[model samples]
Target: MSYIIMEIKKISSVETYPVRHEVLRKGKPIETCIFKGDDDEQTIHLGLFLDDQLVGIISVFKEQNNLFSETNQFQIRGMAVLEEFQGKGLGTKLVKEAEKHCINLNANVIWFNARENAVPFYEKLDYKIIGDSFLIPEVGIHFVMYKKIH
Candidate 1:
């Protein structure tokens, strides 16, 4: 068996767009990967690198959802791992790193609109669905999922 060297680090929002577009918005306009608040001062983007090559990414924004009244909540968005590098616990490592960052910011909760197929993945990470699944125009179905990370 071969070993892979991985490193997780805080990255700029722009650094996340490439993997986000490739994995989450394939065949769609590159602009689709540019999320709102990506440039916010309080937002953070995390990238997972394997052998010095970026292969996974996730972003966290200081935002609150109306569904939850938590004063210090961070929204997780644009989480994606490259097709070849997926299913190897890289996504979990990215999330664990995000949680550490969130805790440092005093955030009590983290939430996101998770794609339907990704529900089980989030569930495995202890995130729970908040309500019924809904459709995102041109994106397909999703559910609001959250976890108390504090």
Candidate 2:
């Protein structure tokens, strides 16, 4: 029997670019993958590795959305799983891990701009849409989604 070794842990912001660019930026400039608060000391980047190969990544920042009443919130940004590994539940694992980290930080909620198609994925995770959908220029339409962690 063969076993697939999978591990998830904190990684530096710089370590996330390759996967981010490949999965999220695609045709856009690589700079588009570098989120605004990626270098902040409090920001958290989590990478999923399978047998030592980085296959997925998710970033969380200590940021608040005015749409949310919570003073303490963490915004999820640049979450993606390599195309070949999609539907394997690795994305769900990364998100669950992030939720644990956010809860530990005493966050009242966690939110993000969910791409139109990704809204269903977030919905399965118990995230709810906050407002009307909007466009992101290079990216497509997105809706603000959030889940109360407190």
Candidate 3:
């Protein structure tokens, strides 16, 4: 069971759109605005391939805020592992890869607005909840979580 991870740009610039949409569609809550390709910043998608077949994906967007810190950081937006592959730790692996990518780029922290149901998963990876809960409409109720990398 070998797997490989690649940047969205490295595969095809247009490939990230459908994967992002599919993940959102499967998990979106009512009253939330649907995610569109334009919502994504340039060059932020990642895909996981196993045996040459694309099977999981995640998107990370970097943000720079003086209040938070001086350096740029990343926030995960889209994430999904194909149904047949969910329990195999692929989601965690995808996250670790994203963190490694951000760290390589000089990021100090990795953060995300994680959905309520996914909180335990992130907690296991050492991410801590940082703020009040909020609803992202189509995305669901989320809590901000962060993990320092630097």
Counted clashes in each candidate structure? 0, 0, 2
**What is the full ranking by TM-score, best candidate first?**
2, 1, 3
Candidate 1 on 1-150: residue-level lDDT in tens? 989888998899878888998999999999999999999999989999988899999999999899988899999999999999889889999988988888998888999999999999999999999989999998999999999865
lDDT-superior candidate, 2 or 3: 2
Clashing pairs in 2: none
Which of 1 and 2 is ahead in TM-score? Answer: 2
- The Cα local distance difference test for each model comes to 0.92, 0.93, 0.70
Better of 1 and 3 by lDDT: 1
lDDT of 3 by residue, 46-112 (tens): 7888756677787777664333664777777677777787788888988988887788888887887
Q: What are the C-alpha RMSDs, in order, of all predicted structures?
A: 1.3, 0.7, 4.2
Query: What are the runs in model 3 whose C-alpha is more than 4 Å off?
Result: 1-13, 27-42, 65-67
User: Which candidate do you rate higher for TM-score, 1 or 3?
Assistant: 1
Q: List the residue pairs that clash in candidate 3.
A: 32-137, 32-138
Candidate 1 TM-score, C-alpha based: 0.95
